[model samples]
Target: MPIVEELIKEGRIERPGIGVTIVEVTDEMIETYGFPKGVAIYQIMPNGAADKAGLLPRDIIVAVGEKRVETIDELKEEINKYKVGDIVKFTVWRDEKEFVVPIKLQQLGG
Candidate 1:
């Protein structure tokens, strides 16, 4: 099993310096369909903010803060400049033109 929840359940992950759980949020996480992406394919992340943002596995990430990301790495690097609780604008192409989707940043543990 993943260590996060298990650690939390077992009281292993204590807040404020008791070895906090760490979740990795990557760029590929926020994905969308467009450009060379002929078909719709959503990005996946085991530990990511998009997951909590209610983004599905097939949800595409078309835009972020006026920047269009074609790859996962591009997405991660861009969002890194911000922190949790910040509202970010994104264009998600589900079946038609890019649809605007605003996501709130959630802390990806320490």
Candidate 2:
């Protein structure tokens, strides 16, 4: 099983279905993505909210709403500030292009 599944089963984390594992973007990653450091998407769950919003693996999330995020913790903290069903804009960098995508947050089990 996925680590995320294990975490969910252990009640150590909530399953929000944003469905993406992220890491802090490093200097190398920033150079590769042609963007400043941010939260780098490592994976995107199939058919999940992030996937539906056009977020893909390797996309660097630079901002959530109007707040800039430089680390995974910052990104998660920003995300937690909003409730499920709230639509928020995410600024992402992919393939040397920057764009904004709106995502409607969802809870996995409620």
Candidate 1, residues 1-110, lDDT tens digits: the string is: 24598487776632211011222224343253223332123453544555555555555565567887765556665666555567788676654456776776655553
lDDT of the candidates, in the order given: 0.51, 0.81
lDDT of model 1, residue 104: 67
lDDT of 1 at 107: 51
Give the least accurate 10-residue stretch of model 2, judged by summed lDDT: 10-19
Best-performing candidate as measured by TM-score: 2
Model 2 spans > 4 angstroms off: 1-17, 108-110
Q: Which stretches of candidate 1 lie over 4 Å from their true place?
A: 1-54
Clashing pairs in 2: none
lDDT of 2 by residue, 1-110 (tens): 46588587776654343778888988886576566789888988788789899898889899999999999888888888776688889999888787999998877543
What is the TM-score of each predicted model, taking all chains together? 0.53, 0.78
- In order of listing, the candidates' clash counts read 5, 0
Evaluated at residue 66, the lDDT of candidate 2 is 94
